[model samples]
Target: MLGSISLDKTTRRVSLRAKALMIFSILLAPGCLGSDEEIDVFYGEDIVPPRATPDFVLFDQNGDPVAFNDYLGDVVVVAFLFTRCPDVCPQVSANMAWIGNELGDNLGTEVHLLSITVDPWYDNSSVMQNYAYDRGLEWPHLSSDLETMEPIWRSFDVGLETYANDTDGDGTVDGFDLCPDTPEGEQTDADGCGVETQQSEGDVQTMHHPLYYIDHTTGTIIVDRAGNQRVYWGDFVWNADMVLDDIMALVEESA
Candidate 1:
Protein backbone atom coordinates (compact mmCIF):
# COMPACT_ATOMS: atom_id res chain seq x y z
CA MET A 1 0.00 0.00 0.00
CA LEU A 2 2.91 2.43 0.75
CA GLY A 3 4.58 1.66 -2.61
CA SER A 4 1.30 2.30 -4.49
CA ILE A 5 0.84 5.67 -2.73
CA SER A 6 4.41 6.76 -3.65
CA LEU A 7 3.82 5.90 -7.34
CA ASP A 8 0.59 7.98 -7.44
CA LYS A 9 2.33 10.98 -5.83
CA THR A 10 5.16 10.90 -8.41
CA THR A 11 2.62 10.72 -11.27
CA ARG A 12 0.77 13.78 -9.97
CA ARG A 13 4.08 15.77 -9.68
CA VAL A 14 4.96 14.92 -13.30
CA SER A 15 1.54 16.05 -14.57
CA LEU A 16 1.84 19.42 -12.80
CA ARG A 17 5.31 20.01 -14.28
CA ALA A 18 4.05 19.26 -17.79
CA LYS A 19 1.17 21.68 -17.43
CA ALA A 20 3.47 24.48 -16.25
CA LEU A 21 5.83 23.90 -19.18
CA MET A 22 2.93 24.04 -21.67
CA ILE A 23 1.72 27.35 -20.23
CA PHE A 24 5.22 28.86 -20.36
CA SER A 25 5.70 27.67 -23.93
CA ILE A 26 2.44 29.29 -25.02
CA LEU A 27 3.36 32.59 -23.34
CA LEU A 28 6.82 32.75 -25.03
CA ALA A 29 5.71 31.49 -28.42
CA PRO A 30 5.96 33.61 -31.57
CA GLY A 31 2.87 35.86 -31.97
CA CYS A 32 1.91 35.14 -28.38
CA LEU A 33 3.79 38.03 -26.69
CA GLY A 34 4.06 39.94 -29.99
CA SER A 35 7.32 41.26 -31.55
CA ASP A 36 9.20 44.18 -30.01
CA GLU A 37 8.45 46.42 -33.01
CA GLU A 38 4.77 45.54 -32.87
CA ILE A 39 4.69 46.27 -29.14
CA ASP A 40 6.30 49.67 -29.67
CA VAL A 41 3.84 50.48 -32.46
CA PHE A 42 0.94 49.62 -30.19
CA TYR A 43 2.17 51.40 -27.06
CA GLY A 44 4.34 54.19 -28.41
CA GLU A 45 3.67 57.77 -27.32
CA ASP A 46 2.81 60.48 -29.82
CA ILE A 47 5.15 63.46 -30.12
CA VAL A 48 3.36 66.79 -30.43
CA PRO A 49 5.07 69.48 -32.46
CA PRO A 50 6.20 72.72 -30.86
CA ARG A 51 3.60 75.52 -30.88
CA ALA A 52 3.25 77.75 -33.95
CA THR A 53 0.21 79.77 -34.95
CA PRO A 54 -1.44 79.22 -38.27
CA ASP A 55 -2.96 81.84 -40.58
CA PHE A 56 -6.72 82.28 -40.56
CA VAL A 57 -9.43 84.72 -41.62
CA LEU A 58 -13.04 84.98 -40.43
CA PHE A 59 -15.77 87.48 -39.55
CA ASP A 60 -16.24 88.78 -36.02
CA GLN A 61 -19.58 89.28 -34.20
CA ASN A 62 -19.93 92.69 -35.85
CA GLY A 63 -19.60 91.18 -39.36
CA ASP A 64 -16.16 92.75 -39.61
CA PRO A 65 -13.49 90.72 -41.39
CA VAL A 66 -10.66 89.64 -39.11
CA ALA A 67 -7.38 88.04 -40.09
CA PHE A 68 -4.59 86.52 -38.07
CA ASN A 69 -2.14 88.63 -40.03
CA ASP A 70 -3.82 91.71 -38.62
CA TYR A 71 -2.45 90.84 -35.19
CA LEU A 72 1.10 90.18 -36.29
CA GLY A 73 2.77 91.75 -33.28
CA ASP A 74 0.35 90.60 -30.57
CA VAL A 75 -0.27 87.32 -28.78
CA VAL A 76 -3.61 85.63 -29.35
CA VAL A 77 -5.53 82.93 -27.56
CA VAL A 78 -7.96 81.31 -29.98
CA ALA A 79 -10.79 79.14 -28.72
CA PHE A 80 -13.52 77.21 -30.53
CA LEU A 81 -17.01 77.18 -29.06
CA PHE A 82 -20.67 77.77 -29.88
CA THR A 83 -22.71 80.44 -28.14
CA ARG A 84 -25.37 77.90 -27.09
CA CYS A 85 -23.13 75.21 -25.63
CA PRO A 86 -24.30 74.02 -22.22
CA ASP A 87 -21.24 72.13 -21.04
CA VAL A 88 -17.51 72.69 -21.44
CA CYS A 89 -17.94 75.55 -23.87
CA PRO A 90 -19.27 77.90 -21.23
CA GLN A 91 -16.55 76.88 -18.84
CA VAL A 92 -13.89 77.53 -21.43
CA SER A 93 -15.35 80.93 -22.25
CA ALA A 94 -15.62 81.76 -18.59
CA ASN A 95 -12.03 80.80 -18.11
CA MET A 96 -11.10 83.04 -20.99
CA ALA A 97 -13.06 85.82 -19.37
CA TRP A 98 -11.13 85.24 -16.21
CA ILE A 99 -7.92 85.43 -18.16
CA GLY A 100 -9.08 88.61 -19.83
CA ASN A 101 -10.01 90.22 -16.54
CA GLU A 102 -6.68 89.18 -15.13
CA LEU A 103 -4.89 90.76 -18.07
CA GLY A 104 -6.98 93.95 -17.58
CA ASP A 105 -5.81 96.78 -19.82
CA ASN A 106 -3.60 94.55 -22.01
CA LEU A 107 -6.51 92.51 -23.36
CA GLY A 108 -6.82 93.81 -26.89
CA THR A 109 -3.39 95.37 -27.02
CA GLU A 110 -0.78 92.90 -25.78
CA VAL A 111 -3.16 89.90 -25.86
CA HIS A 112 -6.30 89.21 -27.89
CA LEU A 113 -9.00 86.66 -27.21
CA LEU A 114 -10.67 85.26 -30.31
CA SER A 115 -13.61 82.91 -29.84
CA ILE A 116 -14.66 81.21 -33.05
CA THR A 117 -18.13 79.72 -33.01
CA VAL A 118 -18.52 76.14 -34.15
CA ASP A 119 -22.21 76.68 -34.94
CA PRO A 120 -21.90 79.36 -37.59
CA TRP A 121 -25.38 79.30 -39.14
CA TYR A 122 -27.35 79.73 -35.93
CA ASP A 123 -24.65 81.78 -34.18
CA ASN A 124 -24.94 84.85 -36.37
CA SER A 125 -23.46 88.24 -35.44
CA SER A 126 -26.46 89.25 -33.30
CA VAL A 127 -26.59 85.95 -31.46
CA MET A 128 -22.86 86.10 -30.86
CA GLN A 129 -23.20 89.68 -29.68
CA ASN A 130 -25.82 88.68 -27.10
CA TYR A 131 -23.62 85.83 -25.95
CA ALA A 132 -20.64 88.12 -25.56
CA TYR A 133 -22.67 90.72 -23.75
CA ASP A 134 -24.32 88.24 -21.44
CA ARG A 135 -20.98 86.73 -20.50
CA GLY A 136 -19.32 90.17 -20.37
CA LEU A 137 -16.71 88.87 -22.75
CA GLU A 138 -15.03 91.84 -24.42
CA TRP A 139 -13.18 89.74 -27.00
CA PRO A 140 -14.25 89.07 -30.52
CA HIS A 141 -16.90 86.34 -30.90
CA LEU A 142 -16.90 85.35 -34.54
CA SER A 143 -18.53 83.00 -37.06
CA SER A 144 -18.74 82.61 -40.79
CA ASP A 145 -20.84 80.75 -43.36
CA LEU A 146 -20.64 76.95 -43.40
CA GLU A 147 -18.49 76.97 -46.52
CA THR A 148 -15.91 79.13 -44.77
CA MET A 149 -16.36 77.65 -41.31
CA GLU A 150 -15.98 73.99 -42.34
CA PRO A 151 -12.35 74.32 -43.32
CA ILE A 152 -11.63 76.36 -40.20
CA TRP A 153 -13.22 73.67 -38.02
CA ARG A 154 -11.18 71.04 -39.81
CA SER A 155 -8.00 73.00 -39.36
CA PHE A 156 -8.65 73.30 -35.64
CA ASP A 157 -10.01 69.74 -35.40
CA VAL A 158 -13.24 71.05 -33.86
CA GLY A 159 -16.11 68.62 -34.37
CA LEU A 160 -19.74 69.69 -33.92
CA GLU A 161 -23.11 67.99 -34.46
CA THR A 162 -26.51 69.69 -34.70
CA TYR A 163 -29.85 68.13 -33.72
CA ALA A 164 -33.49 69.22 -33.86
CA ASN A 165 -35.70 69.04 -30.80
CA ASP A 166 -38.49 71.06 -29.11
CA THR A 167 -37.87 70.44 -25.44
CA ASP A 168 -39.77 73.54 -24.32
CA GLY A 169 -42.81 72.54 -26.44
CA ASP A 170 -42.57 76.00 -27.98
CA GLY A 171 -43.14 74.64 -31.52
CA THR A 172 -39.64 75.60 -32.58
CA VAL A 173 -36.47 73.52 -32.45
CA ASP A 174 -33.50 75.57 -31.35
CA GLY A 175 -29.92 75.14 -32.43
CA PHE A 176 -27.06 73.87 -30.17
CA ASP A 177 -28.67 71.21 -28.02
CA LEU A 178 -26.86 68.47 -26.13
CA CYS A 179 -30.02 67.22 -24.41
CA PRO A 180 -33.01 68.10 -26.60
CA ASP A 181 -35.49 66.89 -24.02
CA THR A 182 -35.14 69.89 -21.71
CA PRO A 183 -38.37 71.88 -21.21
CA GLU A 184 -38.77 75.42 -22.54
CA GLY A 185 -38.56 78.63 -20.43
CA GLU A 186 -35.80 76.88 -18.56
CA GLN A 187 -32.68 78.96 -18.03
CA THR A 188 -29.95 77.96 -20.51
CA ASP A 189 -26.80 79.37 -21.99
CA ALA A 190 -26.78 81.93 -24.81
CA ASP A 191 -27.43 79.23 -27.44
CA GLY A 192 -30.61 77.88 -25.78
CA CYS A 193 -28.60 74.65 -25.34
CA GLY A 194 -28.74 71.90 -22.74
CA VAL A 195 -28.80 71.95 -18.96
CA GLU A 196 -26.81 74.66 -17.23
CA THR A 197 -24.89 72.80 -14.55
CA GLN A 198 -24.31 69.63 -12.51
CA GLN A 199 -23.96 69.11 -8.78
CA SER A 200 -21.95 66.84 -6.47
CA GLU A 201 -21.41 67.10 -2.72
CA GLY A 202 -18.80 65.72 -0.37
CA ASP A 203 -19.13 62.72 1.96
CA VAL A 204 -21.05 64.86 4.44
CA GLN A 205 -24.86 64.98 4.58
CA THR A 206 -24.96 68.43 2.99
CA MET A 207 -25.93 68.92 -0.67
CA HIS A 208 -23.60 70.64 -3.15
CA HIS A 209 -24.83 71.99 -6.45
CA PRO A 210 -22.11 72.97 -8.90
CA LEU A 211 -22.57 74.50 -12.31
CA TYR A 212 -23.05 71.97 -15.12
CA TYR A 213 -22.13 72.98 -18.63
CA ILE A 214 -22.15 70.92 -21.85
CA ASP A 215 -19.56 68.26 -22.75
CA HIS A 216 -17.99 70.06 -25.65
CA THR A 217 -14.24 69.86 -26.07
CA THR A 218 -12.31 72.65 -24.31
CA GLY A 219 -9.28 73.22 -26.52
CA THR A 220 -7.82 76.71 -26.40
CA ILE A 221 -4.86 77.41 -28.64
CA ILE A 222 -2.28 79.93 -27.44
CA VAL A 223 -0.39 81.78 -30.12
CA ASP A 224 2.72 83.70 -29.20
CA ARG A 225 3.84 87.05 -30.58
CA ALA A 226 6.22 85.30 -32.96
CA GLY A 227 3.24 83.63 -34.61
CA ASN A 228 4.14 80.29 -33.01
CA GLN A 229 1.37 78.25 -31.48
CA ARG A 230 2.78 77.67 -28.01
CA VAL A 231 0.24 75.73 -26.02
CA TYR A 232 -3.08 73.92 -26.33
CA TRP A 233 -5.28 73.31 -23.33
CA GLY A 234 -7.81 70.64 -24.24
CA ASP A 235 -11.04 70.55 -22.24
CA PHE A 236 -11.69 72.71 -19.19
CA VAL A 237 -9.01 71.01 -17.15
CA TRP A 238 -6.69 74.03 -17.51
CA ASN A 239 -7.47 77.02 -15.32
CA ALA A 240 -6.90 80.72 -15.96
CA ASP A 241 -3.75 80.91 -13.86
CA MET A 242 -1.99 78.15 -15.76
CA VAL A 243 -2.92 79.72 -19.10
CA LEU A 244 -1.77 83.12 -17.91
CA ASP A 245 1.54 81.69 -16.71
CA ASP A 246 2.24 80.14 -20.11
CA ILE A 247 1.28 83.35 -21.83
CA MET A 248 3.61 85.30 -19.59
CA ALA A 249 6.40 82.87 -20.28
CA LEU A 250 5.82 83.23 -24.02
CA VAL A 251 5.79 86.99 -23.65
CA GLU A 252 9.08 86.94 -21.76
CA GLU A 253 10.59 84.67 -24.36
CA SER A 254 9.48 87.02 -27.12
CA ALA A 255 10.96 89.97 -25.28
Candidate 2:
Protein backbone atom coordinates (compact mmCIF):
# COMPACT_ATOMS: atom_id res chain seq x y z
CA MET A 1 0.00 0.00 0.00
CA LEU A 2 1.29 3.41 -0.94
CA GLY A 3 1.48 5.88 1.91
CA SER A 4 -0.76 8.93 1.71
CA ILE A 5 0.34 12.56 2.03
CA SER A 6 -0.76 16.16 1.77
CA LEU A 7 0.58 17.63 -1.45
CA ASP A 8 0.27 20.74 -3.56
CA LYS A 9 1.27 21.63 -7.13
CA THR A 10 4.68 22.98 -6.14
CA THR A 11 5.76 19.53 -4.89
CA ARG A 12 5.42 20.74 -1.30
CA ARG A 13 4.18 17.88 0.91
CA VAL A 14 3.88 16.91 4.54
CA SER A 15 3.30 13.66 6.42
CA LEU A 16 -0.30 12.48 6.49
CA ARG A 17 -0.61 12.33 10.26
CA ALA A 18 1.10 15.65 10.70
CA LYS A 19 -1.16 17.33 8.20
CA ALA A 20 -4.24 15.66 9.69
CA LEU A 21 -3.37 16.93 13.13
CA MET A 22 -2.70 20.40 11.83
CA ILE A 23 -5.95 20.54 9.92
CA PHE A 24 -7.95 19.32 12.90
CA SER A 25 -6.39 21.75 15.33
CA ILE A 26 -6.25 24.80 13.11
CA LEU A 27 -8.98 24.41 10.54
CA LEU A 28 -11.63 22.22 12.14
CA ALA A 29 -11.43 22.96 15.86
CA PRO A 30 -13.37 25.91 17.25
CA GLY A 31 -11.51 29.05 18.29
CA CYS A 32 -8.32 27.89 16.67
CA LEU A 33 -6.08 30.61 15.25
CA GLY A 34 -5.08 29.94 11.67
CA SER A 35 -5.97 30.73 8.06
CA ASP A 36 -9.51 29.89 6.95
CA GLU A 37 -8.12 27.49 4.30
CA GLU A 38 -8.07 23.75 4.95
CA ILE A 39 -5.36 21.28 4.00
CA ASP A 40 -6.41 18.02 2.33
CA VAL A 41 -4.83 14.59 2.67
CA PHE A 42 -5.53 11.53 0.49
CA TYR A 43 -5.65 7.77 1.05
CA GLY A 44 -4.44 6.86 -2.42
CA GLU A 45 -1.16 7.41 -4.25
CA ASP A 46 -0.78 11.14 -4.63
CA ILE A 47 0.53 12.71 -7.81
CA VAL A 48 3.31 14.94 -6.52
CA PRO A 49 3.65 18.16 -8.44
CA PRO A 50 0.41 17.27 -10.12
CA ARG A 51 0.10 17.74 -13.85
CA ALA A 52 -2.84 18.66 -16.02
CA THR A 53 -4.92 15.82 -17.42
CA PRO A 54 -4.91 15.51 -21.18
CA ASP A 55 -8.06 16.92 -22.70
CA PHE A 56 -9.98 15.25 -25.49
CA VAL A 57 -13.31 15.32 -27.25
CA LEU A 58 -14.87 11.89 -27.41
CA PHE A 59 -18.34 10.54 -28.08
CA ASP A 60 -20.24 9.30 -25.09
CA GLN A 61 -22.74 6.45 -24.91
CA ASN A 62 -25.32 8.79 -26.39
CA GLY A 63 -23.07 9.59 -29.38
CA ASP A 64 -22.69 13.16 -28.22
CA PRO A 65 -19.35 14.87 -28.08
CA VAL A 66 -17.99 15.28 -24.56
CA ALA A 67 -14.91 17.38 -23.85
CA PHE A 68 -12.77 16.92 -20.78
CA ASN A 69 -12.08 20.66 -20.55
CA ASP A 70 -15.77 21.37 -20.18
CA TYR A 71 -15.60 19.64 -16.80
CA LEU A 72 -12.74 21.80 -15.46
CA GLY A 73 -14.63 23.22 -12.50
CA ASP A 74 -15.66 19.75 -11.26
CA VAL A 75 -13.72 16.91 -9.72
CA VAL A 76 -13.51 14.16 -12.33
CA VAL A 77 -13.20 10.43 -11.80
CA VAL A 78 -11.97 8.59 -14.86
CA ALA A 79 -12.17 4.79 -15.17
CA PHE A 80 -10.76 2.67 -17.97
CA LEU A 81 -12.77 -0.40 -19.02
CA PHE A 82 -13.99 -2.46 -21.95
CA THR A 83 -17.41 -3.94 -22.59
CA ARG A 84 -16.10 -7.42 -23.46
CA CYS A 85 -13.80 -7.69 -20.44
CA PRO A 86 -14.80 -10.79 -18.49
CA ASP A 87 -13.51 -9.89 -15.05
CA VAL A 88 -11.74 -6.80 -13.73
CA CYS A 89 -13.59 -4.29 -15.88
CA PRO A 90 -16.95 -5.09 -14.32
CA GLN A 91 -15.48 -4.92 -10.84
CA VAL A 92 -14.02 -1.50 -11.57
CA SER A 93 -17.37 -0.36 -12.91
CA ALA A 94 -19.13 -1.52 -9.76
CA ASN A 95 -16.64 0.42 -7.63
CA MET A 96 -17.28 3.53 -9.67
CA ALA A 97 -21.02 3.06 -9.33
CA TRP A 98 -20.66 2.84 -5.59
CA ILE A 99 -18.76 6.12 -5.57
CA GLY A 100 -21.36 7.68 -7.83
CA ASN A 101 -24.21 6.72 -5.51
CA GLU A 102 -22.32 8.10 -2.54
CA LEU A 103 -21.82 11.37 -4.37
CA GLY A 104 -25.63 11.81 -4.28
CA ASP A 105 -26.75 15.21 -5.53
CA ASN A 106 -23.11 16.23 -6.04
CA LEU A 107 -22.83 13.79 -8.89
CA GLY A 108 -22.76 15.33 -12.39
CA THR A 109 -22.53 18.76 -10.74
CA GLU A 110 -19.64 18.98 -8.31
CA VAL A 111 -18.22 15.63 -9.42
CA HIS A 112 -18.17 14.06 -12.90
CA LEU A 113 -17.58 10.38 -13.62
CA LEU A 114 -16.38 8.92 -16.89
CA SER A 115 -15.63 5.41 -18.14
CA ILE A 116 -13.52 5.21 -21.28
CA THR A 117 -13.11 1.97 -23.20
CA VAL A 118 -9.69 0.32 -23.62
CA ASP A 119 -11.06 -1.69 -26.52
CA PRO A 120 -12.58 0.98 -28.69
CA TRP A 121 -12.36 -1.22 -31.79
CA TYR A 122 -15.11 -3.36 -30.28
CA ASP A 123 -16.77 -0.85 -27.98
CA ASN A 124 -18.24 1.76 -30.29
CA SER A 125 -20.84 4.30 -29.22
CA SER A 126 -23.73 1.83 -29.51
CA VAL A 127 -21.86 -0.88 -27.64
CA MET A 128 -20.89 1.57 -24.91
CA GLN A 129 -24.50 2.71 -24.65
CA ASN A 130 -25.75 -0.87 -24.33
CA TYR A 131 -23.14 -1.70 -21.71
CA ALA A 132 -23.99 1.36 -19.62
CA TYR A 133 -27.75 0.79 -19.91
CA ASP A 134 -27.52 -2.90 -19.06
CA ARG A 135 -25.43 -2.14 -16.00
CA GLY A 136 -27.70 0.76 -14.90
CA LEU A 137 -24.73 3.19 -14.96
CA GLU A 138 -25.84 6.74 -15.70
CA TRP A 139 -22.40 8.23 -16.33
CA PRO A 140 -20.94 8.65 -19.75
CA HIS A 141 -19.11 5.64 -21.21
CA LEU A 142 -16.90 7.07 -23.92
CA SER A 143 -15.63 5.26 -27.05
CA SER A 144 -13.89 6.07 -30.28
CA ASP A 145 -11.66 4.47 -32.90
CA LEU A 146 -8.26 3.07 -31.97
CA GLU A 147 -6.46 5.86 -33.74
CA THR A 148 -8.16 8.47 -31.63
CA MET A 149 -8.03 6.61 -28.31
CA GLU A 150 -4.37 5.52 -28.33
CA PRO A 151 -2.91 8.94 -27.56
CA ILE A 152 -5.50 9.55 -24.89
CA TRP A 153 -4.69 6.21 -23.34
CA ARG A 154 -0.99 7.03 -23.37
CA SER A 155 -1.57 10.41 -21.81
CA PHE A 156 -3.52 8.83 -18.96
CA ASP A 157 -0.86 6.13 -18.39
CA VAL A 158 -3.26 3.38 -19.41
CA GLY A 159 -1.25 0.30 -20.32
CA LEU A 160 -3.14 -1.68 -22.96
CA GLU A 161 -2.57 -4.68 -25.22
CA THR A 162 -4.64 -7.02 -27.37
CA TYR A 163 -3.76 -10.65 -27.78
CA ALA A 164 -4.88 -13.64 -29.86
CA ASN A 165 -3.72 -16.27 -27.41
CA ASP A 166 -4.75 -19.94 -27.85
CA THR A 167 -3.15 -21.63 -24.86
CA ASP A 168 -4.30 -25.19 -25.70
CA GLY A 169 -3.82 -25.01 -29.48
CA ASP A 170 -7.55 -24.46 -29.96
CA GLY A 171 -8.69 -22.70 -33.12
CA THR A 172 -10.59 -20.06 -31.20
CA VAL A 173 -8.84 -17.22 -29.45
CA ASP A 174 -9.11 -17.19 -25.68
CA GLY A 175 -11.16 -13.99 -25.69
CA PHE A 176 -14.34 -15.56 -27.05
CA ASP A 177 -13.69 -19.12 -25.89
CA LEU A 178 -16.01 -20.46 -23.22
CA CYS A 179 -13.82 -23.51 -22.55
CA PRO A 180 -10.07 -22.87 -22.40
CA ASP A 181 -8.36 -26.28 -22.39
CA THR A 182 -8.68 -28.06 -25.71
CA PRO A 183 -6.29 -30.88 -26.68
CA GLU A 184 -3.55 -30.26 -29.20
CA GLY A 185 -4.50 -30.52 -32.93
CA GLU A 186 -8.15 -31.18 -32.07
CA GLN A 187 -10.96 -29.40 -33.85
CA THR A 188 -12.96 -27.13 -31.57
CA ASP A 189 -16.43 -25.66 -31.33
CA ALA A 190 -17.48 -22.04 -31.16
CA ASP A 191 -16.61 -22.15 -27.51
CA GLY A 192 -12.99 -23.21 -28.35
CA CYS A 193 -13.03 -26.66 -26.72
CA GLY A 194 -13.28 -30.04 -28.46
CA VAL A 195 -15.99 -32.60 -27.64
CA GLU A 196 -13.41 -34.46 -25.54
CA THR A 197 -12.99 -31.35 -23.43
CA GLN A 198 -16.66 -30.44 -23.50
CA GLN A 199 -18.29 -33.88 -23.25
CA SER A 200 -17.28 -37.20 -21.66
CA GLU A 201 -15.88 -38.74 -24.87
CA GLY A 202 -13.08 -38.13 -27.33
CA ASP A 203 -14.63 -36.31 -30.28
CA VAL A 204 -13.57 -33.21 -32.17
CA GLN A 205 -16.25 -30.69 -33.09
CA THR A 206 -15.35 -28.13 -35.73
CA MET A 207 -16.24 -24.48 -35.36
CA HIS A 208 -14.16 -21.35 -34.87
CA HIS A 209 -14.65 -17.76 -33.84
CA PRO A 210 -11.86 -15.20 -34.01
CA LEU A 211 -11.52 -12.62 -31.26
CA TYR A 212 -8.93 -10.63 -29.35
CA TYR A 213 -8.60 -10.09 -25.63
CA ILE A 214 -7.64 -6.71 -24.24
CA ASP A 215 -5.49 -6.39 -21.15
CA HIS A 216 -5.32 -2.95 -19.59
CA THR A 217 -4.54 -1.08 -16.39
CA THR A 218 -7.54 -1.38 -14.10
CA GLY A 219 -7.22 1.86 -12.11
CA THR A 220 -9.24 5.00 -11.48
CA ILE A 221 -7.82 8.52 -11.50
CA ILE A 222 -9.18 11.45 -9.53
CA VAL A 223 -8.75 14.81 -11.24
CA ASP A 224 -9.04 17.96 -9.15
CA ARG A 225 -11.08 21.03 -10.03
CA ALA A 226 -7.94 22.43 -11.66
CA GLY A 227 -8.06 19.59 -14.21
CA ASN A 228 -4.93 18.00 -12.76
CA GLN A 229 -4.64 14.31 -11.96
CA ARG A 230 -4.31 14.16 -8.20
CA VAL A 231 -4.91 10.67 -6.85
CA TYR A 232 -4.88 7.19 -8.31
CA TRP A 233 -6.40 4.07 -6.77
CA GLY A 234 -5.75 0.78 -8.49
CA ASP A 235 -8.77 -1.48 -8.95
CA PHE A 236 -7.30 -4.36 -6.97
CA VAL A 237 -6.74 -2.13 -3.94
CA TRP A 238 -9.74 0.20 -4.01
CA ASN A 239 -11.51 1.19 -0.79
CA ALA A 240 -14.80 2.90 -1.62
CA ASP A 241 -14.88 5.16 1.41
CA MET A 242 -11.30 6.29 0.99
CA VAL A 243 -11.88 6.96 -2.70
CA LEU A 244 -14.95 9.02 -1.86
CA ASP A 245 -13.05 10.97 0.77
CA ASP A 246 -10.31 11.81 -1.70
CA ILE A 247 -12.86 13.06 -4.23
CA MET A 248 -14.88 15.12 -1.77
CA ALA A 249 -11.70 16.62 -0.40
CA LEU A 250 -10.84 17.86 -3.84
CA VAL A 251 -14.38 19.13 -4.34
CA GLU A 252 -13.95 21.16 -1.17
CA GLU A 253 -10.87 22.88 -2.51
CA SER A 254 -11.25 26.42 -3.75
CA ALA A 255 -11.13 26.99 -7.47
- The TM-score values for the models, in the order shown, are 0.61, 0.76
List ranges where model 2 is wrong by over 4 Å.
1-40, 167-169, 174-181, 184-191, 199-210
Give the alpha carbon lDDT tens digit for every residue of 153-184 in model 1: 66665666655544554233444433355455
Weakest 10 consecutive residues of candidate 1 by summed lDDT: 38-47
Report the Cα lDDT for residue 63, model 2: 99
Candidate 1 lDDT for residue 134: 88
Worst 10 residues of 2 by lDDT: 1-10
